[model samples]
Target: MNARPGSFGRFVADADAAGNLVVQPRMGFCAPHHMRTGLALTKAAAATTAGTLTIDSYTRVGDLAAARTALGEGAPLNGYPIAAHPAACTRALLDGVVDDTFPVQVRHGSSHPEPIIRALSAAGLDATEGGPVSYCLPYGRTPLDVSVDNWSRGCELLASLMPDGRIAHVESFGGCMLGQMCPPALLVALSLLEGLYFTQHGIRSVSLSYAQQTDTAQDEEAVRALRRLAAEFLPPDVDWHVVLYTYMGVYPASEAGARELLSASARLAVRAEAQRLIVKTAAEAHRIPTIEENVRALQTAARAASTARPAAIAPGGSKGTGDEYTQARTLIEATLELSPDTGRALRAAFARGHLDVPYCLHPDNAGRSRSFIDSTGRLRWSATGAMPVPPAPTSAGRTSVSARELLDAVHYVARRYDAAPAD
Candidate 1:
């Protein structure tokens, strides 16, 4: 989308096509408890502040019936209206679960928009000129493999689908940890490259979806680093939105507790001047969140934003941001200059299990038992067949899994090849 300068309020106003404002709610980071409770809070906030609330319903990860239940139960309590996407709304439409259905504009895969647009038109929900509908794309971090060839194909696909420019806003899918691995320089380059493409096209609004981490000491540092990187990469010229989620991966015990944690995190984000804040519920660690959880989390985030104030600028201001950008640039330059060395080092690290690259969520190691040691020295896995799925902890705690364990697993699997008498 074309990047433009606008306030959150302005963006909301511009996004509406039904002559009414709608707030799109999503929660994919926190535990389910937080999401359920948060939806209740969001409805209350919208009622008190905005004209009226129309929920953009879709589960980031959950069951639909339970979500509908939470919405039905909570909407009345908060005195606001709710809406569901086509998928969930389809069932609700048939069973009379909701008042109306809002279809989500989706690109089938990687920027190809034609099929989706055609489908929307065929379904008679084409609000291209000024529809109340909004588009959602399941965009993860630009995959490591997003080469020029892929980019060209993606651009061509989008161009074909959106010839008339009917889409109002685009919401990217799935939370990612960009700052954890991508250096600031790389972020700037990538942003510049992608930003140019998006701006060249007619796309107007975009939101960054980031997986949330707890505000522990280590996490706080990570957040600070990430914030600095964002400052460097996020152009002030374009309208920007940020979605922060709580770590449901670790804390999935209670929804209420998760909400509390998310609220605290939202407060932190507000201080940082994040345009939009989303709090994920705690239930996501084990299962997909029901619609109720999604609504609850959105509700809680809305409430939190209502009372939040901007925080004072940190000591470094944009200095840290600039430095990270410079460092990233240097790294990229070095990599280009020493591709052979860099590749060898990267492969070596991968082989040793010292570095866990993105997309390689699982890896195997040989000859050594595996265990993850937490900050408190607790080991979670050993001799991996399938790692134990620990119960979601109530408090933020750490557990370490050793690289050796992965190596052992790799070795065990490789033995079959080794024993196969020379092929």
Candidate 2:
């Protein structure tokens, strides 16, 4: 597909017109310093000549406005863009503060589609019917059975709501599993299957969001594995992207450290020919990142990508780490196989039309859970515990919650309370 006219182009042109080197993609404008850096990077990387590269920037809602300002004022494009947040928390983002946001939407057996739909409306973004902005549907740490059913139902609901095709992308989150590793084959197959499912359901883009250890050679190998999967499974017609979000709390605490990690990540991405790169801010694992901190982090990552030397693609190793590559391949393969079973369960749950009320470990469950369910139906409270069950079926028949609603419920539960024993 032809590239869409992105905010970056306008930023570049604006910078050039204004005689500034800096160009911010968010506002489609540029300044002089930005231009010089771009030129310098272009010239410096001429030897490696990987061809034209594109980078999109992403951040959280609290940082969106500032990120937009930095981008418009001229933040570098060596990284990919993707703002991450729990599905229910991004109402502010869709309110139009950031360019985009990816909210996790976990599916239990039930559906709660209103928040997403309402958020889209509140943001003045259209639905699939009205050219809605791209939103992420994240399957959080829900059990495989619930996750698949939730995702499938979510897709069906989205398709139904967006006959005109509003969704632009769909992504999944990786959680700690079996040593926090998914088998390689499973990863590959799931990637393709997800792409197919989204494509079939009318979503035009698909991506995966997972955290990685920046300190290990294994991380680099995992990137290579992803590249191979992209090459083999990604349909030529599909707009596919992969995001290797760093676990900021793990390594690279200082500016210099962050730069080194970013440089390494950029090289890996370039070698892999990844469509986009998402460089996590240093504050990620520790706490929520402030806007200024995030911008600084992106700046550091951009510099690394722009200035780093392209490492030779080792015969089989990435950065001389053979084990990394081997492990990555193995893990991805294993994960891909499990995806179908996961998908099947998710589809079945959606078919059953049960609501997955979210319960979390956090203290904010009251506001969060209420936001997910509709105004008319009350949350069915279990006599034994705090777990809120779905209200009884209404006169219109058992009131069915959308997939989005189920996810919201899951998010609420996960954030505020531990999962209750499954009924």
Candidate 3:
């Protein structure tokens, strides 16, 4: 397990250095054979790819007894219950499928992931993604302070695995908070904050994520902003990369529209120099895609990416500055000054309304901030709340968004894409 060619972070770094944009799927299955087949198909895809083992909801919510009961009853669960299944069984699933060229990461949305980490470790896996705030606020009523303590201990546990020769990599889910229309600057700030929190808790390898937003130019600026903030704030010794998720909000009902949106995301990843992309299938608006559908989506994204040219930024680096950069940096520095401990600082930031999510209803969130999609398709804050950053020029005169406007903003991308012809 000692840092090898197969380490998740190292593999991505090497691929980025070689100018290959890595694409991955949010795929998992209940049956061992099915999960193994899914991973094998992902690795064999026509893209520079990675594998994911998404955990079931029961396990994510710490309902292991229910997970076990479903297993015993032969009822199909939504994803692999790593905590409920035997370690040996997981090992068998990954035995020959994972290699130096292919690395697998467990994706579970959990505020309390210590047990999941322990389970993954026993099966000889190390990389996983989630955050104290990101996983807590969006999914349930878990208190922010409690989630912070849980993640602090969980990160330490994952870091301890490094001594066994495995490279422990953690990706912060902070950037994808509330799925859509939250404004890019706040998303960027949260992602960087969570990345800093992971480093404080002992994770040396990390990745910051940003989801594609309403406008391509705005999305590009947000990704570059994230990279710049990482350079300014992360420990120099920490290994890190940028990952872009396909638009996480409403998907277009038209297959053609969905394909266009997915393609647009791949192009954005290339322009922003993101090392990896988490793709969504055309089936996203309907149901869980079949393995064959996932493979097709991976290949489609790969083709779109190959036709793209990297932005003027240097390979593996970015130096662009925009409004997003200024705002995100201001928020991050303000939060860091609150306390030496990142976990405590995050809790304080939220408690004081310094870090507020636009539509998030978590008990910890201030819930005072609001965002809207402007006529130009850029996400702007309609209310800055108590945050340190000022509202952008487009939002200067706006103090409120009507319920009808909010619904339209959420469906903005979908309607636009669906209206255009696929060809």
Best by TM-score: 3
**How do the residues 1-423 of candidate 3 rate in per-residue lDDT, one tens digit apiece?**
112444688899888888899999999899999999999999999899999999999999999999999999999999999999999999999999988799899999999899899999989888999999999998899999999999999999998966455678999999999899889998999999999999999988899999999999999999988988888889888888999999999999999999999999999999988889999999999999999999999999999999998778558754658889999988998898899999989999999999999888898999999988887889988888899987655535768889999999999999999999768
Candidate 3: residue pairs that collide? 1-165, 1-166, 2-165
TM-score of each: 0.47, 0.46, 0.97
**Measured by TM-score, how close is model 1 to the native structure?**
0.47
User: Rank order by TM-score, top first?
Assistant: 3, 1, 2
Between candidates 1 and 3, the one scoring higher on TM-score is 3
Look at candidate 3 and tell me the lDDT of residue 422.
64
Q: Give Cα-based local distance difference scores for all models.
A: 0.35, 0.35, 0.91
Runs of candidate 3 with Cα error greater than 4 angstroms are 1-6, 313-318, 393-396
Comparing 1 and 3 on lDDT, the stronger one: 3
Q: Which 10 consecutive positions of candidate 2 have the poorest summed lDDT?
A: 127-136
Error of model 2, residue 309, in angstroms = 5.6
Model 2 lDDT, residue 157, Cα: 56
Task: Give a tens-digit lDDT track for model 1, residues 151-187.
Answer: 3343334434543533333333223322222112222
Off by over 4 Å in 2: 1-114, 121-143, 159-167, 175-197, 214-217, 248-263, 284-286, 309-342, 345-423
